[model samples]
Every structure is written in C-alpha cells, then in structure tokens.
Target: MVRCYKCGRKMKYIRGLKFNQYAVDGWKCGDCGEVYYDADQAQRILLLNKLKKQKFRLKLNQVRSNLILRIPKEVGEAMGLRNGSEIEFSLKDDDKIIIST
Candidate 1:
C-alpha cells in the first residue's frame, strides 16, 4: 500500500495509467490527484523524454534495388531497437514519414 505524500492518505493502485502517452502502473491519490510511479517505470519515462529531445540526420543507402535507412546508434539504443526488430511505417500529409516500433 502506498501513502500520499501531500494529503497523508492511502493511494490507490492504478493499472495502465497513462503517463506522457505511455501506459504505466502507478499509484494515485484520490484526494489530491497525485500520481506516483515505481523506479523502473519512472526510468522508462525519463529515457523516452530524452529520446524526444534528440534529433538525427541520416542518409539512405541503396543495396540492389532496395533502399536502406540506417538508424543512429544512440537512437537505436534508446528505442531498444535490434537488427531484426520489426517497425511500422506511416506517411503523414505527404512529406513526412513516421516510423514506430
């Protein structure tokens, strides 16, 4: 059981709590509306915050008839992307392409 720091009340365990658009398990205080996350989930959110602040410039390489876009090492590590990892690609408007894992 977690206790709220501000109101000195028992916090309720909430599953799938949305934190910065990510689903995380945490405790919430009903009185003060305070939310708290465990260390592991907090670390994950911090990493995602760092990833959002970074920008990368990449080039496309052509092998045979396919073009390969290489992901930077730092970005790959932050996203936990591996060699065989599967990703989804989507086009926005007409000029921007979004890649999600």
Candidate 2:
C-alpha cells in the first residue's frame, strides 16, 4: 500500500514484469512513469533476488523415482531403535514430511 513517487498516489498492482537485476527497486508507477525507491543499493538487491527466483526453474533435469535421505543415528535411536522399522509419511506444504509410527 505504498504511494507512487511521482504522483504521491497509491500504487496500482500490476504484476508479471521482470527485472533486469540492476534496474529495479521497489516498484514502478503505472500512472506516472517513475520507479519507486530509485536507489542503486535497493536496485542491486532486487536484481539479486530476481536472479535467485529465476534460478528456481532453471534446472534442466532430475533423477527419476529415486529418493535419498541422510539422518543422524542418535535421533533414530531416541525414536525407537530399529533398522527396518515401519514409518509413515505425508506432505506439509511442499516437502515430504515424515512421521514415526
């Protein structure tokens, strides 16, 4: 709910525009052509964030049907004590969450 820099009016929400990594900070005014928070540090940080987000879908390939997990032995020992014990699992949010049975 920030105001536009040029017009001093509330900014309108217009998504889908991508940043140039060094050319964006805060947001732009649709009514006026002014960019919000026009500072070099802010713009560079926004660009770094944009780069991190862009890296999300940039992976080309992944392994199929194989999952791997590495766990500490002390946690397993405290939970129950077995090599082949049964376990239950469910997803919370987007990760494969585990529950001990």
Candidate 3:
C-alpha cells in the first residue's frame, strides 16, 4: 500500500485511470485526490504526451494510377523510418488510419 505524501493517507490503487485518454494504473489519495503512477506508467504517459505534440500537414499526390504520400524528413527521422522500410497500415476507424513500423 502506498501512502500519500501530502495528507499521509493510505492511497488506493485505481486501474485504468484516464490520463489524456490513455488508461494507466495509478494510486489515488482519497483524502487529497492526488494521483500517482509508477515509473513505467509515468514513462509511457510522457512518451504519449510527447507524441501528441507532434502534428504535421502532408499533401497527397497522384501517380500514374496510384496515390503517393510523402513523409516529411523530420517525421521520418523521428519515427526512425528509412528508405524501403516496411510498415503496416490498418484502418483505425471510418476516418482514421494507423501506420506502424
């Protein structure tokens, strides 16, 4: 059991606590309503927050009979994507697509 640093009250473990729409396990202080995450959870949340700050506008071009999408240099470098790198594409929803390497 974890104790709250502020109120010195026993903290309760909360599963699937929402942080920026991401679910993370956290400890909540009942007395002060303070939430805390473990090291792994905190790192994951930080990475997710960093990714949320990156936004790019790209243009779609038409080839002979196919559509071509160009990735910006910064985006590619950040993602560690290289020329001829294999990536997977999937439909996340009706309007969103997920690309993973």
Index of the highest-lDDT prediction: 1
Q: lDDT at 9 for candidate 1? A: 99
Tell me the spans in candidate 3 whose CA falls farther than 4 Å from its real position. 52-88, 91-97
By summed lDDT, the worst window of 10 consecutive residues in model 1 runs over: 37-46
Which residue pairs come into collision in candidate 2?
none
Instruction: Put down candidate 1 lDDT per residue, 11-86, tens digits, no spaces.
Output: 9999888877888889999999999977688677878799788787889999999999999887787678999999
Candidate that scores best on TM-score: 1
Candidate 2: what lDDT?
0.55
lDDT of 2 by residue, 1-101 (tens): 87886699776544433455343345667778666554554555554454445422222343586564534454444445487777776776775464556
All candidates: TM-score: 0.62, 0.31, 0.52
* Regions of candidate 2 where Cα sits further than 4 Å from its true position: 1-64
Expressed as tens digits, the lDDT of each residue in 1-101 for candidate 3 is 89999999999999988786778898999889999976687676676567668886779999999987898876666566899998998999999988888
